[model samples]
Target: MSDQNVAARTRAALDAGEGILRLAPTWVPRSFLMPGARLKLSREDLYALGTHRGGIDERWFSSTTPAANEGAPPDEGLSYVVHDGAKFTLRDAVGAHADELIGPALNAKYKRWPVYSKFFDNLGPIPHHMHQSQEQAEKIGLEGKPESYYFPPQLNWTGNNFPYTFMGLEPGTTKEQVRRCLEDWNKGDNGILDLSKAYRLKPGTGWLVPPDVLHAPGSLVTYEPQWGSDVFGMYQSLVEGRRVPWELLVKDVPKEYHQDLDYLVEQLDWEQNVDPEFKANHYLEPIVRTGSEQEGFVDKWIVYGTVAGKQVFSACELTVLPGRSVTIKDPGAYGLVVVQGSGHIGKLDVDSPNFIRFGEVTKDEVFVTHKRAGEGVTFKNTGSEPFVSLRYFGPDAHSDLPKVGDYLKVG
Candidate 1:
């Protein structure tokens, strides 16, 4: 399609929704992972993409970046904005209206929506893996990803297989030990987890994970807000009796260093991996925004903290009492997902979906433009239960952003 056509449709969407655009669910599948069946996607549609493509385990929100899954369609992970029975990819909308949609500052620096959030529900634990840092990703013409996770209490009713994550290596672990694990990749079960300590995953909490950190995430439906990049390298040799290919370990590494054990070992951020106080540095708990608890609504910062000292992303959980309403203002645009109850957000209807079929449209998700956010949007809880929503922002969106351990300081 031509730029003129996209721009026209984008403008029409913005005008129709009063600066907020409803988004279609963007489901993604991972060939190696088992779906936890908690994302509200209908059981009949879990394998809608065909079993060969694996189960639909993830649902991305307000995304402009496509999934890097091999053989995936070009628009696999991209979100589409729906209006007046017509739709266009959010990527096209942002490309046509970057300044007004995402804001001028972000558009000037990133030239696109640089961050996105997703709900990834896995049955067991993911293999130990690490995302390349920007310095390393630059080698492959992609950006580094720094992600944060929040395990929503509503979605995680049951911990499927394992409810503990192995994050970073034990403080006394040696580089040679890790090198040996890689050398033993061809052997069954490389035993990388033996060198790391596991933390019991808890609901209503989160963690800030920077690039180059090794993590084997546990069985929980995680709400992740992160930089817009899909670059990662799995380090574990086997998971759940399934042998992980060696190609996955060096997929993001340069072609020349694919077989170089030492170079591959150097990919890890050694100091971080060996940090004794890893939890103290990365664990996060919801911090109530000061003065945000009014008679009808309350807001809590669910995801916050800087990545490499830069405010790359943040998220908030807003709960409105039934029969009440609240108006909120923010510094920038955001992507929102309604998790519980029914409500009205500005000019759009919002409801937490119970079960969604593949290729179905939902009122649970929307993108609020920067202008509408700054002007303030009113949300009303029209259901019998409390209306709950989760919204995530782009870089530098919060001037008073909370730190990792700020919740402890709250009285």
Candidate 2:
């Protein structure tokens, strides 16, 4: 077909709420066909194959890995781990069986990059913003005067915003652009920021940010997992001393793939508050549990509060009292991030260097834990006051069923 004909057909299909987009098979032998040959499939076929194909069951968990406590003289205020909750590690729970979660085609794409854990800490009362002062920038290792030589600094408000980063795990020009954008933002002073948009995250709630979306975690602490690729765009640069022209930044925008930017902007929930149920200044929102009944795994919705089930990822917040400990039994890769107060994990012996300790949980330092199946870890609050921690586990760490009403209603 000619270019004009293709354009007309695309327009007609889009207007009718349908389009002739092509889906490719998950796997293809390189030498099986001629170069540039196209094979079209449907979404249903892809999904069916994905479910049946032997794929890597990839999963991720976030939390503080507690220190091993050796038998040292017991300190009067020593903290310790308890065995009451689920305990698991990504390496054992998901990493070892990644071939079962992600199919061969997708696995090949991921092999191009190294997988690393991503954790964000907001130890202070407020979260980090993409556009903020240089002092804050220096603290986070992003420091430079704003000038024509670089983009302005961007501060991210994790307390009142839902900050998101994306990874393009597929092969496509659009995905490549997204990855490149993130790399540029991370290396420069000015990062992506959308002033007309913001997100409100209740403490302890997190959601996945797919590729090609404008998002940030509002105030409070947050953890993220992605395809291990960096690509993004900076919508605003408001830091002192550094600033870039909007036109210049927009010129670099991936216009072909950015048609959804306006739609994303419209999804912002500006009227919502982080804390709706308590007088505490911390942002708090209710999490909805969804998708807990899928075969082989459990998924829960904890965008704000505690909603448990089976899925690829699970997380919860706990308050440990002095000398109290919580034991996790799942024995898989997990994350233990300290949000407030002080605590210890594993053996609480004072001399054990691996003993987890928290003076003031800051965004710069987040604790992560990795365990094996059937093995357990513990946490104890050794501080004079109560200790708080956030824990995360990989997909299917708990259950393997889907929940009715577990869908993400808002963007």
Candidate 3:
């Protein structure tokens, strides 16, 4: 498409939806992981794209980043803005009008919308892996990934298989031990899991995972709000008797460094991996952000804080009681997914479907622009029950966002 055409389409989309873009659902799958099937996707359609493409276990929102899956189409991870039955990739819109979609300051610095969010469901556990840091990924011509995971109560009613995630290495675990595990890649189970501790997964809770952090996410379905990148390297060679090729470990490394064990071992964040108070540092729980019961609504920050002092992203869980309404405002552009009951957001019709088929158009997700958010949008609970939603922002979106320890003070 021509740049002129994209700009014209972006303008039309904003005008059509009153600055709120209705986003089509974007599904992504991982060949190595089993689907938990809690993402409301139809069972028969879970592997609708075929087992070769893997099960549709992830639903991405407001995304402009491309998924790095081996056989992914060019537009695989990009979100599409639907307007009057016509659509265009959000990437093109950002490329056309970043100032209007995000903000002038953000556009000037990032040159694009640099963050995205998604919901990932897995039946069992993934191999322990670390997303390369920006410095590391630069060698592979990609950006680093710093993500936060919030387990929505609505989607996690059933924690299939294993609900425990193995994060980081034991406080006393040595680098030589991990190096030995890497050396024993083809020798059945590398015994890496034996050096890690599994934390019981809890719904309505979340954790921030920085780059180079080794984590094997368990069976709980997770709503991950993250930076716009998909570069990662799986450290574990065997996951449940499934042989993870050594090439997977060096997928992001430069061709020359592919066989450098020392370089690979150094990719793990040693200090973070050995942190004794890991929970106190990375654990997150909902912290109410003003408003109240009398106001008929409440908004809580489920994901907040910075990575390396850089504001990467943030998220909030909102709830409004039946027959009640309130106007909520935010600082920057954000994408929202209706989780529980839903009624109205702004002038748009909203509903949380119990089941969704592939290619189904849903009002369950939308992208709120910077202007519309600053002007505030009214949310109404027209349903019989409380209406709930999860919304997340891009980098530096919230200036007054809560820090890691703020949840300790929430009542």
Candidate 4:
């Protein structure tokens, strides 16, 4: 389509809330790569990129007790640990691509990750609290209510905490507990229910958990791509070794939303597997599409492979055919991490070679590209083998489509 036509359609879609925002930048034109240029990121760099506030403080880890009834007050020291959910934004890295960068692809990537001062309006440190009963309070030698700490809901504002460590599931944990806990909390009447029956993610598969769902990705290594918000609710707290009072937590939730909490919980999947085979690879799924056909941006995907609706995120053990790259038409800002292999992106004139290399990709050290309407970018795999990488777009790509099946599945 003509540039003007594409822009017009995109505007209409945004107006009607129906356009798809592509977040990956797997494909860039060959002309963009600079001579001897290759971009890369290390494990440390990846952690640094995701660590919005800074590294985790050892004091918070040592002083905080895991027992719920320890009667410990909220440790002010713990407030500094900021979760990545709200810290990272597209706007923070725009100047790197001050020039046009490239063409259509560059424009699309920029729109998704805009250069705004504040990526999100509300960002704060998650507070620790305990739920207490009058009886438990007496046992702990407390005066009134027994303080019980509840687990924080996974992401959305649903009630339920899926215990997770940094790398994977905690040792000595049974899959049954994972399933049962999720089910028990999703009782279908504003209570938990069994989610074992719902669709589960396969290796190399990625699924999008819409807002307000009682879903947890289990303790596993995940490159979570989400909207620009860190706001969430807690239901249990293993950190404090206590269950948060339902009354207090529920008080903040809207009555109408709370009334249907049970029904929402009932939709969780309980019969999930814990084996590495199930969690090791990429899992791609469909998510809701936003924007318009003319706006040049269209459908969004929960990508785990070469093409995430035109952008590329992680491509471990994946192949991008020679002389062929995925073109992202979405007008949102986007990023790339070369987990494996070597490649070039955007217009050849402004293109830079990736230097840092790691098993996984991080947002830090990523090459940002800016594209205009009717223009797009591509990723060329220079290596003899398949090129592997991961990418992400701006907040505009967030959508409400349920189930990974709603997006494309690439094996």
Candidate 5:
């Protein structure tokens, strides 16, 4: 289609949806992990893309960023707006109407929606890995990814397998000790797990993980709000008796530095990694925002913290009691995913589906435009239970958002 036609149609769809676009669920696969079986994806279709593409354990929210999967199509991680049987990627719409979609301030700063959120479900813990820093990632032409994880209690009715995450290195751990682990890369185990401590995973809690911080996420349905890019280096050589290829360890590194153990260790933030107060610095608990507990609904900030001294993204958990409704106002654009109950956001009906087949379009997800969010959107819990959904924003979206040290006050 012509560019002008596409632009016109995109604008028309935005207007028709009242600045709230209906998005098709975007499924992403991970070749190295086991599916948690809680994402509501049809159990029989877990391997819908075949075992080669691994399991569809992740359901990406309204995202414009494409997944960094080796064999994924151009639109793999990009969410599409389903309008009158015709579909166009959110990426295209944002490119055409950034001012309308994300707002002029955000558009002028980042140009496109530069962050995304997802539900990452896995049966077991992943290997210790760190997303490359901006400097490290730019060597290979990618952006740094700083992410946050909130384990929602509603979806995690049962913890699948191991429910513990090993985050960062022990405070007293030395760089030489890490280098020795890399030296023993060819040797089994690598002893990397021995240098870190695992925290018991708790539901309704979260942690802020900045770029270059090593984290081995555990078994749980995590609601992750992170920067747009996907770039990481695995530090563990073996996980669950499966051998991790060295290629993955150096995947983001230049070919010249692939064999440099010192360079590999340099990928981590040494001071942050060995910080004794790691928990105090990164731990998170849901904190109710001012005036958020209205007549029928309660809104709590789930993920609120700066990554590298900037408010790049934040998330909130909004709950509406049965047969109740409330109008919510936010400062910026966000992607919404309903985790429980059936409800209506304005005139749109959204339900929590028990099963979803591959390529199926569900109404459980929506993207609120800057205008709709600012004007306030009415949400009604039509079901008998609480209507729950997670909505995340990108870059200075929340005005009264909590600070990093605010979690320290949570007794």
Candidate 6:
């Protein structure tokens, strides 16, 4: 379609829903991981993209950033906006109407939506890996990824194989130990995880992970709000008896430094990785947004805190009581996903589905334009259960937000 046509359609979508756009579910696969099957996708459709391509283990929300998986389609991780029985990519909508969609300040700066959220469900655990820092990724002309995780109780009814995540290096871990693990890559089980500590996964909790920090996420349905980049390097040689190719360890490294053990080890943020207060600094608990539960709804900050001292991204879990309604005003644009019950968000009907088929559109996802968010959107719960949804905002969305250690003061 022409750029003019996209712009026209984008405008129509914004107007039709009063700045709220319903989005189609965007499923993403990972060749290295097994699906936990808690994403509401039908079991038969887990391998809908083919077993070789891995299972549909992730569902991205309001994303423009494509998945970095090898052998994936061009639109693998991009979301589609459904309006008037027509569908168009959210990427193109942002491209054609950036100012109207994301706000003039963010559009002028990033020129695109700078962040995306996803539900990544795995059966066991991911390989110990680290996303490149901006300095490291820029060497390959790519961007960094700083992500935060929130496990929602509604989706995490069952914690699969392993309900614990290994994050960062132990306080006294040495670089030589890590280097030795890398050298033993060809051997079965490189034992990189031995140098780390695992925390029991808990639903209704979260963690802020900086770029270049190693992590092996456990089996739980995770709601992640992250920077719009997919650059990472796996340090573990094997995961759950599955071999992790050497190429994956150097996937985002410069070609010249691919085999440089020192360079690979240097990629880690030593100070942060070895911080003794890792959990105290990175772990997050929901903080009520200066309100009481007696109100009609509860708004909690599920994912907050800065990345590199900047408000890179943030998220909130809003739960409207049955038969109640609330109007919320945010500072910027956000992508939303309904996780429980059914409700009316502005003009769009939102519902959490029991099962979603491959290539099917769902009412559970939507995007609220910056203008609409600032003006306020009313949510009405029409179901007997609590209506729950998650909304993630882009960088610098709020002038004042909860800090990393703020949850400690909650009580």
The estimated TM-scores of all candidates read: 0.99, 0.36, 0.98, 0.37, 0.97, 0.99
The residue-by-residue lDDT of candidate 5 on 165-184, one tens digit each, is: 99999988999999999988
Q: For model 2, how does the per-residue alpha-carbon lDDT over 243-327 read when each residue is reduced to its tens digit?
A: 4333322332334434454422322222221113211211222233321222211223332222222133345545556556665
Per residue, candidate 3 scores C-alpha lDDT tens digits across 40-124 of: 9899989987899888899999999999899889999999988887789998988887888898988999998899999999988
lDDT of 1 by residue, 127-156 (tens): 999999999999988888999999999899
**In candidate 2, what residue range of length 10 has the lowest lDDT sum?**
146-155
Clashes of each: 0, 106, 0, 117, 0, 0
- Give the true-structure RMSD of model 6: 0.8
Kindly indicate the candidate among 1 and 4 with the higher lDDT. Answer: 1
Evaluate model 1: give its TM-score. 0.99
Q: Candidate 1 overall Cα lDDT vs. reference?
A: 0.93
Q: Model 3 Cα displacement at 169 (Å)?
A: 0.6
Report each candidate's C-alpha RMSD, comma-separated, in the order given: 1.0, 22.6, 1.1, 17.1, 1.4, 0.8
**How many backbone collisions does model 4 have?**
117
Per-residue lDDT over 7-50 for candidate 4, one digit per residue giving the tens place of the 0 to 100 score: 44434322232121212121111110111111222324333312
Best by lDDT: 6
lDDT of 5 at 105: 97
Clashing pairs in 1: none
Candidate 6 worst ten-residue window by lDDT: 287-296
> Which regions in candidate 4 have their CA more than 4 angstroms from the true location?
1-200, 239-300, 303-319, 322-329, 347-374, 394-411
Worst 10 residues of 5 by lDDT: 288-297
Q: Which 10 residues in a row give candidate 3 its minimum summed lDDT?
A: 239-248
Better-scoring candidate (TM-score), 3 or 4: 3
